[model samples]
Target: MHFCELGDPGELSPSQILIRTEFSGITNGTERHAMLGEFNWNHFPGRHGYQHVGIIEATGNEVEGFNTGERVFYGAYVGHRAWHIVDTENGPPLLITLPDGMDHPYCALFGVAGVGLRCVRRVRVRPAQKVWVVGQGLIGGFAAQAARAYGAHVTVTDIDENRLSLARSCGTHRVLDACDERVFEQLKEGGPYNIVIDGSGYKDLFFDIQEHALLARRGVIGALAVRGETTFDWSMLHQRELSVEVSCHFAVEDLTILRHFVREHIIHIKPVVSHRVSIDEAPDIYTILRDRPAELLGVIF
Candidate 1:
């Protein structure tokens, strides 16, 4: 059952506004975790839990900075179908309207891209800083490219050979097998990096990397993980003075930065589509995503 449909959309009270989703892009990080119920229940029952890149089709008189037919990137819950009426008393602030040249599918992938871009922003990579990115899916690719645009030397690591090859073709300097038994040794050989970006959706992986991260000493460790409850060891970070930053959402400024980067060809924003399925096929695709999910970015409806 789609958790988003657990509520009524037609009942926006006198104080609420409504939004319509032209197309909702599923984020690999948060979507995967939520599908498994691996999230803090404290944040539930809010207007948003998933990241939806949608547009406002209608609104209450109280709503400002929005109008019908203006394409925008907004967030909402799981039931962001073709048309949705929401009570937008508290929603993510509208990021921006789609530029003239950018298309809808590209807009669909923007949420995932923004998450990665925010990761780079959090670590504060300087020009020419050496960076290492783990995971070579859409977010990983975007993070690696974003760091490079920030003037960092980037090396991308992933277990999938095809993804690694794609990252290499996309100008990644070094590619390492993250699944190898000597993965830490391989990373150490290239270590003393200024930053390490983790785009893997699993929180368990983050816990495992504590020793090898070297994050405390001379590098920044950034994550786009969908974490629930976990333990953090701050004492270990005291020695290396590493900065640990977790990025959740993209601010409006981040959207502007992404837009400028995409327009300037610095971000290389592209739809990482594996298949195109119709809205009618969404149920099957959801099952696919729920069962044998691969390194897929999304199935656009």
Candidate 2:
């Protein structure tokens, strides 16, 4: 990844605000896909970040409910930078004044957490339901916590022990090492999951779920991970009458609910944070992300 100067943002408009960024979270999966040009929408030499936390340095005269010096989370689509000029009336509809005592670093992860929340809500997770989350990366970990907050019995699996430990810390009912030889047996013990979420970005897991009969009849499958393509047996799906649900970017309401959960300590973000570096260190971090992704999580700039 390369950084280039885009010059000044120019003068702020009547409905705009100037922000000095404090922290920005990496949307690991999506950004990696973009970097590799895996997605059809990806273009060369493009900016790619959505999670941003910054202080409002200046606000337009017409701006209401937001003022200078307030730390807020802004989902800037223009990508990560040192400064941002947000048009309140016509900008991305993801600007919010963070609650008092919210950690700026953790707040930077709201974008990814909100995606997890949206996935859980879209699958209609309910109290006492059994939910299995594949993978314990940032999105998977957050999804497990969100499911638990909704009163579901959440089981999370991952090849990374550290991530599994993080999931356990976040209140997942069960954490399994996906590499274990008895993994399938262990999953069967918690079998017939009401909802299964794919946060691993591994298409093969979908077929594994079917082969092992891990999901209950009519159970919902949430494809929350980014992937190039997915292939599954049509006959198996028809026989079980299962439903497949998919969610992309989160909505504002998802962020609102996620903030409440984080404030209540029901959803944990700090535990998954593995790095906090300055903007200058971004290139090194991205190299690790490309070469050794398992070494990183919850990175903030």
Candidate 3:
């Protein structure tokens, strides 16, 4: 994608506010997929981000409950730049007031936290039950923590040892090497898991989970990562009568719930963030991510 300076959108309308971005979180899932032409709705030079924390620089006369210099957490499809115009009258709610003493960088992770919350909820995990997460990227890692918070025994797997290590530090009960062919056999020793989550965004791995992992009778399979087509044994699926559930983006209420998770310290924000860069370095960083996926996790811009 081409990057260059552009004139800022001048002056806010009556219900608008001008935001000076302090930090924006890079999403390895949607943004990476979009940049690679895998996301159908995004085109080349397409706007790229949905996670940012900023200060309200200017507010129109009609705007209420927001003041200049107020720190706010906002999300939109186009928030990677230094400045953004938020018209409250248009589109989904874009601004959320940052709680006192909340770290801006951590606020940028709210979206990811929400994804984890949603995915775990979809799986309908129960207390004391085993939950297997097949991927240890940011989302997967967070999903494992969320499951643990829900009182489930969480195990995470990934090909990247670094990511798996991060998951271990985040309190996952077990971390497995996804590349190992015996991974599923090992996982089954804990008994068939109540839920098996696919957060690796790897279609082949998802297929492998379907083929090898033994889920609890009528267990749930939650797809928390990006979706793609892959073939697996339909007969196996039929015989097991497994339930597959797919998750989408977070909703407004999900954000509210995530805020509570943060307050209660159920979601660990610090370990998930792995890199930091100025907005100007974003282009190069994206290139690195494209070439080497394991080199980074949560990146702040």
Candidate 4:
């Protein structure tokens, strides 16, 4: 990925706010997908990313509740940049003030974490239910936490031991090594999960779940990862009466709830952050993201 010299954000309108970005988070999965042209909607010379934590540099006369100099987390369909002009009154974008003394760098992943929160909410996770998350990337890590916060008995699996360890530290009830030969047997012992959240974006894993009969009757499958297509045996889903749920980008309501969770320390962001680099190093980071994703998580600039 290459950075372009976008000209300065011009003067704001009466209902606008100018934010000077302090940190912006890289969305590893989505950005990598875009770079690889995995999505049909991707185009040449496009911008990607929606996470930004910045300080309000100035505000228009009609802007209320938000004042100049306040630190905030704002998300829009914009690229990683130094400045953002937000129209609060007619918004496709939204911003929220940061909590007192919240760590600025960690807040860069707020949008990523919000996606996890939205997925759990969309799948309707309930207290005391068993939920299995099949990945330990940033989104999966946060998904495990969100499920636990919703009172589910959460189990997370990943081939990466580091990620599994992080899941344990995040208070997951169980962590399984997907690389283990007997992993499926182990999963069967924990059988008939109430919900299975696919954060791995692996079609084979989804097929395996069905072939192994891992889900209970009427179990919900939450597909939070980006994938081109998912093809599986129809009989398996038909027999179990299973339902597949998909969630895209998060809503402002999801972010509001996520902020509360982050403030209360219910969802840990710092542990998931494996890299922190300056904006100048972004191109190099994107190289690593495309070539060796296993080496990174929660990268901020």
In order, candidate lDDTs are 0.68, 0.87, 0.79, 0.89
Candidate 4 backbone overlaps, count: 0
lDDT of 2: 0.87
Off by over 4 Å in 3: 61-68, 90-92, 204-213, 235-237
**Which candidate would rank higher by TM-score, 2 or 4?**
4
Inter-residue clash pairs, candidate 1: 128-151, 216-240, 216-242, 217-240
RMSD of 1: 4.1
Stretches of candidate 1 off by over 4 Å are 2-19, 42-67, 84-92, 180-186, 201-217, 227-236
Cα RMSD (angstroms) for every candidate in the order listed: 4.1, 1.6, 2.4, 1.4
Q: Give the winner by TM-score: 3 or 4.
A: 4
TM for candidate 2 is 0.95
- Which model, 2 or 4, shows the larger lDDT? 4
For model 2, residues 1-301, the per-residue Cα lDDT tens digits are: 7888868768888888898888899956777778888889889889989999989999889888788989888875678988888886864457888877877688998998988999999999999999999998888888889999999999999998888887877778899999999999999999889999989888698789899999999999999998766898887689999989998878778888988898888888888889988889999988988888778888888
Model 4 TM-score is 0.96
Candidate 3, residue 251: the lDDT equals 71
Candidate 4 per-residue lDDT over residues 1-301, each given as its tens digit: 6777768888899999999999999867888888888889899888988899999999999888899989999878688988999987865457888967777789999998999999999999999999999999988999999999999999888999999999999999989999999999889888779999999988797689887889989999999998776797888779889989999878888988998888888999999988999999988998999899888898999
TM per candidate = 0.79, 0.95, 0.89, 0.96
Model 1 TM-score, 2 decimals: 0.79
Tens-place lDDT per residue, model 3, 1-301, is: 4577868778678888888888889867777778788866866667878887888899888787788988877766774788888886764565677777656677788777778878888778779988988888878888898899889998888888888888888888988897898877887776578898888767775466555666877888887888767566776567778778889777767777677777787778877787887877887888977887667778887
